[model samples]
Target: MQKQRKLVILGDSAFAEVAYECFTHDSDYEVVGFSVESAHLKRDELFGLPVVPFEDLEKHFQPGEVDFYAALVYSQLNRLRTRLYQEAKSRGYRAASYVSTRAFVWHNVQLGEHCFIFEDNTVQPFVRIGDNVVLWSGNHIGHHSTVEDHCFVASHAVISGFCTVGRSSFLGVNVALANNISIGADNWIGPGLTISADTEPGQLFKGESPAASKVSTKRFFRLKED
Candidate 1:
């Protein structure tokens, strides 16, 4: 087992905050700071810890001594967490992962660097998860599913057997991936989607729209204006 020391949060999201709490409670990690990308960042503090810029996090916490976990949550937008995780790793920052005590992971399951498997996730046998993944709460990873590098699988997603989720893919909440499927790289799967076939690289998949409510446009406008 690696000796846990001072840890750093790599983003300013609620996920980062949750990781801070989880690590402090369950592990030997002492969270030293937070980090943000050069662009699209605000402020300089998270819960009183200095918000170190992703580019210059090392100035605040050295890589050799301090471990860092990217705390970005995946969304409809493409691969932000994946991009930042790779950048941090390239900068020589050690990526961290959390397998919650409530989670059930098989002893032989292989989880690579920089992954966070949250509460109640059931990781079946022979699963291979690559670097920088977030398996949020209540996910079911069926046997032999390979989750590639930089993928973010949000809460309550179901990845069935023999599936291959490619690099930088984002699976939104309640998504159900069919067995023996291959999700290509950079794909953004919207929430409530069900995929049954191989997705092409960079594909954005969405669910079928529900039939419009019987309410007329006038009713819709009135509801919006209210």
Candidate 2:
């Protein structure tokens, strides 16, 4: 068997832990340590590995010897992750992308740097996903779809074929985009929304949350239980 590639993960947040678990189990990279900013450094160790400061990561782990993965969430509409990804690039460190082995990504699909595609994501043919994009589990990215940079697509979102999701867009859970639709930049698409037409830039579409029923569940069911 081939030797595993050593990796240094940036950040120690929940997303960092999740990224570590996935990379450890499903990918070709071995996570050696984690790195964070000095001000945000709370602990010295995570997952039984040393947590190095991002400012001095090269001192502990050489960039030439190890690859780096920025494990950050969609804070600031994914701008945080995108910023760190750029910092890594400026430091001459190559960004690592995670595409789960269980995801059905087409052979012709093109994915950019620092992308995180979780399990059960079905990416159809001719899909082009840009840098620092996060695709949570169970999403369907249909054929010829283009998801631009710094976008965060939540679980169960369905981006139909020939759709174009612009940069920095946040697609909530269960959101559905119809075929040939164009979602503009920095749009916030709320949960359970169906976008059949093109959206303007910086639009915020919020779906109404389900209201609670006046009657209790026990009274509504009316089933006798001894």
Candidate 3:
């Protein structure tokens, strides 16, 4: 049997815990510890492992011995995760990526480091997923699509064929993109919105919430008075 690679996750939030569960059970990596910035180090232990300070991480574990995964969500439009990923690389630590066992990625897919692709994701042929990306459950990346670096795509998003999602974008759940659509950098596409045309950089798209009916539920349904 092959030995599992040692890994350290950088963060202690919900996403970090989820990453721990996925990497521990599904991947060929063993999570040994976690690290956070010194100012934000709220706890000393997590999941029975030590949580060390990022400033002093090298004193605890050598970069050559352990790989790192920045398990952060799309905070600051993914700039936080991108910064830490680049920092870890600058410190000579290899960034780790996780593709769930149940995901169907084509043989020719080009996936970059520090990415976390959850279960039920269908990545078709000729797809290119760049670094520090998070594709949540049940997303569809059609053939010839490109999701650029530092992007976070929530569950059930559909990127059709020949689409290009630009860097640092946050795609909300159930968002769908038409074929050949090109989304510019730093976009925030809200849930259930469909993008048919190309988008400009730093655009924000959200659907307006529907207003409630004026009539009461009892009157509308013809219920008897109490």
Candidate 4:
């Protein structure tokens, strides 16, 4: 059997724990430890492994001895993850990407470093997913689509063929983009929205909740009222 590569995860949030589980069980990487900023280092251990400070990470585990995965979410519009990913690279630690074994990625997809592609994702051919990107479970990246750097696409998103999602964008769950759509940088597209046209940079698309019906459930369903 091939030797497993050692890895260090940066962050202690729920996402980090999920990453640990995925990498430990699904991938060929062995998670040695976790790290966070000194200020946010609440615990000294996680999953029975050492949780060290990011500032002194090199001292604990040399960069050359292990790779890194910035297990962060779309905080700060993904800028935080991007910054830490770049910083880890600058510190001479190679960034690692995780693609779930259950995902279906086409042969020609171009996936970059520090990416986390969850289960049931369908990545079609000629797709380009940039660095520091996160594709949550059950997403569909249609053919010839490009999801730029530092973007976070939540579960069940549908980016149709020839679409382009710009850098640092946050696409919420169930967001669907029509074919040839161009989503601009720093955009925040909320859940259940369907975008058919191009959007400007930093645009925020929020879906409105449906209004409550004037008729009560008892009236609608003919149920007995108390």
By lDDT, who's the top model here? 3
TM-score of each: 0.83, 0.89, 0.91, 0.91
Model 2 / residue 226 / CA error / Å: 65
Worst 10 residues of 4 by lDDT: 209-218
Off by over 4 Å in 4: 1-3, 209-226
Q: In model 3, how large is the Cα lDDT of residue 7? A: 94
How would you encode candidate 1's per-residue C-alpha lDDT over 1-226 as one tens digit per residue? 2436888888888888899888878777888888887795798888888987787777888878888887877643325676777787788877777788889999999999888888999999999999888898999999999999888898999999999998868888998989999987767777888888887766666556322224432232232221
Q: Name the candidate, 2 or 4, with the larger lDDT value.
A: 4
Clashing pairs in 4: none
Q: Residues 177-198, candidate 4, lDDT per residue (tens digit)?
A: 9999999887778788888889
TM-score of 4: 0.91
Report the lDDT tens digits of candidate 3 across residue range 1-226.
Answer: 1337999999999999999999998988999999999999999999999999998999988989999999999887787898899999999999999999899999999999889999999999999999889999999999999999999999999999999999888899999999999998877787888888898766767665322234433343343442
- Clashing pairs for model 3 are none
Superposed Cα RMSD, model 1: 7.6
Better of 2 and 3 by lDDT: 3
Candidates sorted on lDDT, descending:
3, 4, 2, 1
Q: 1-226, model 2: which lDDT tens digit per residue?
A: 1337988999999989999999898898988999998989999999899998889988898867888888887676666777788887788788888999999999999999889999999999999999889999999999999999999999999999999999988899999998999998777787898888887766667647332234432233342321
Residue 63 in model 4: lDDT:
75
